[model samples]
Target: MAEDLNIHDADPVEEFLPVYGMVLADPALYHLAVSVGETLDRGDRWAGAIRRQLTHAVAAHLLGTYTRLKPAPETVRGGLAPWQLRRAQDRIRADLAQAIDLRAVSESCGLSVSHFARAFRQSTGIAPHSWLTGERIARAKVMMRRKDRTLADIALACGFADQSHFTRAFAKNQGTTPGRWRRLMEPEARHATMP
Candidate 1:
């Protein structure tokens, strides 16, 4: 298996099939086969339901890989190490409300900014700016719990330049305005109490 291809990734088969030529792994699609073997070994004659579940899991796990195993691209190789990833995430969390400086992050990791950006993308599958935006949105979601907090205040706290910017970004990511999301939260509480 290619180093970049996680069996649990969204599309493992497609990921592996591309690098099938360069890879040294056998083409038997062993993961699914092993799953079936283990499932049958339970030896319960009445295990039909369990067998069905195991089959479904195996199918989902081997999706796309059976026919077209592939190799990972050279450029995608060598992502940040575990510690570096933790450090980078920590730094991003620390400055969630501020503009992240790529140069500063790279310097902190002892890597050039461009190198850091490439490795970060390969490792995380998203750009640093995109990740920062996602983090901001997540933070906004948490802060939205305070029903009394104005959207503008939440926006500023989450590092949006202003209320309009925050609303636009929030709407873009969340498929609704902050006010609407907040309203949805309150109804959940009402439903919980009723139940």
Candidate 2:
């Protein structure tokens, strides 16, 4: 039918018919088809435009449903390939003091930004930014062990904008300000340093 209309794009119904068989068994598809039929039967002035619009709508619906029903390929189901994950992680860790550009990281892994983000989340169970923030926090924790290192120094080293930013993020993640956290860790630091 699309061919008769000189449409070069593959017809959604024809593409999925072999796998899904007739769509009439699906109530939504059945209702849509019935409605389109009735609209055409009425032979109103807007029939031509309505038919075109509804036909595309039906095709889009079928395509969406087909994608939802289809299982992702096994290799991609678990998310990014091992090499991609390693590359993305290494890139993100290469310089914690610098702002992370997700676009650059995704490109390094030969993926689009959205795809890389989704796959990264699937592989690590967290968004890339969240992972980066966690890493920053972890690094800040280590730096806090050195009493000589001021919160401002640690914040700059961990890619935070300033002491305030570090304090906010630390509080959000650890439920305490960086100063309070350092105080809390001071005892541990003392114990660990004692021979």
Candidate 3:
């Protein structure tokens, strides 16, 4: 004599009992659930299909987690602020090997020179010039590792003006000369790579 319940109200606890039980045992089903959520959000049929596949993957992940197996570590939280900084940082990073103007960096962020320097230092915990120097040195290290590049070339490419200037700056910032760093990175690359 009772009215029938709709699909959404069909005693989900009872209906999902089999699924929950299976997922609990499998420890991987949670990933499948997360993927399904993502797929639904993408607003594309193909995404939905991909989500269906990921639903299975999520299930497997959940199964592993529930079982106390080696579930993947949680991803670090990233947010919009870092993304905004990344856009500006990309420009700075690209021009590190050149004569970087602090004013330009500030202008890029729509701030005046002094205001930009202060904000940048506050956010990055280093002065803009220091940050730029570090970036240049990091790039030089990458170039030095290639072995095809000479210390002089690296110095020039990294905007040190001359080999002596590069050596002094590298030593000041990196605690070693460019040549020494390259040797430490690749002992075999010594003669063949040096200019």
Quantify all predictions' global Cα lDDT against the true fold.
0.69, 0.73, 0.58
TM-score of 1: 0.60
- Cα lDDT tens digits, model 2, 1-195, are 333333332333433422322444677787778878878666667987888878877766776565222222234485999789879978998898887899999999999999999999887767888878867887887778687888999999999999999899888876668887666654555567879
Candidate order, TM-score descending: 1, 2, 3
lDDT of 2 at 131: 73
Compared with the true structure, what per-residue lDDT tens digits does model 1 show for residues 1-195?
Answer: 323344222233322222312654644546656756777767676566767766665554455444332333234457887677668877887978889988878888889999899888887777888778867977887788777689899999989999999999878766779888777666556567873
lDDT of 1: 0.69
Q: Which candidate is the best by TM-score?
A: 1
lDDT of 3 by residue, 1-195 (tens): 001111221222221111221433433454556657766668878997797667555544444333212222222232113444455577778766677676766677777777766666665556767767766776776677576878888888887788898889888865667776665655454546768
The best-first sequence of candidates by lDDT reads 2, 1, 3
Question: In terms of lDDT, which candidate is stronger, 1 or 3?
Answer: 1
